[model samples]
Target: MLKIAMFTLAAAVTASVLAPTAHAAHSRIQFLAPSGNIGCQLGATPDGSGFAWCKADEHGWVTPQSDACPRANVPGAIGEPGGENLQLAEGQAPCFGFVMSQLFFDGQYAPPTLGYGEKRSVGSITCSVERAGVTCSDSKSGKYFQVSREAYKLG
Candidate 1:
């Protein structure tokens, strides 16, 4: 009887632990993008923010990773046609965690105007673990760049 009771208790405990594993948690964060172009690579480093733009007209060639540009490996490189996750560094832009993908972009706007500075909305892509809360950063559209919030949601 004693052995049977112990086995039953162990089985119940194991079931409780495994039950929670069946249900997975998810998190979603949204940020606003500028009214301008899309496909620009935007990322944040622990120190500051960084963006990669392609100057096809000026450089006579497309290259964001070249020595001339400040943000290399940000969005994409020549022949790559950059995407949201342009292999940006998360540690550098502590403000935002990492590059996820571009959620919004105005199709009407032409590639960023020269010297005018094409602004874009940038944010990170992240999720939670073990049903815990996750922190994510998003950017707001404006002249000044600021972290919108630390989105807390289920994993």
Candidate 2:
């Protein structure tokens, strides 16, 4: 009975020490720019690689029509749906994406604002919400994507 009690205590202590660290490392990453124009998400892939993504509420720019986008007659698609969202994957060039849908939730369902000048990092990728726009990049690849109402850039 004494040996069992000591083992149980040891297990409990070990779990307490490691629980917080595990949650911190794998917490979900999702937020929006304070401008209310951009939403971003940083997360891990099935292979454990990280990627960053952001989308604009409105933009002056247009993406080249791809068959995948099809100038859809759908909501949240606006004009050219394919290019409204930008993505930067680990060690890969930034690219435009077709959001496919634009359904949005109201009130508490909406993600919290990242606020201008705020930055978040997940592994090697870092993203910043700025007055100019939202920018996300990969340190190892030196690749980034920035987007706003007026323009966007990939490098």
lDDT of each: 0.30, 0.73
- Which pairs clash in model 1? 25-155, 26-155, 44-93, 45-92, 45-93, 45-94, 46-92, 46-93, 46-94, 75-86
Backbone clashes in model 1? 10
lDDT of 1 by residue, 1-155 (tens): 99999999999999999877653211122222232222233344334444322111112222223232123434333333232122323323322122334444446533332122223333433211111111222332221112112221111
Residue by residue across 1-155, what tens digits does model 2's lDDT show? 99999999999999999999997656447788877888877766656677777888777888544444333222123455356567677877776765444323468767778878899887678999999999999999898989888898889
- Candidate with best lDDT: 2
lDDT of 2: 0.73
Query: Model 2 — which ten-residue stretch has the worst lDDT?
Result: 68-77
Q: Which stretches of candidate 1 lie over 4 Å from their true place?
A: 25-155
TM-scores, all models, native as reference: 0.20, 0.70
Could you tell me which residue pairs clash in candidate 2?
A: none
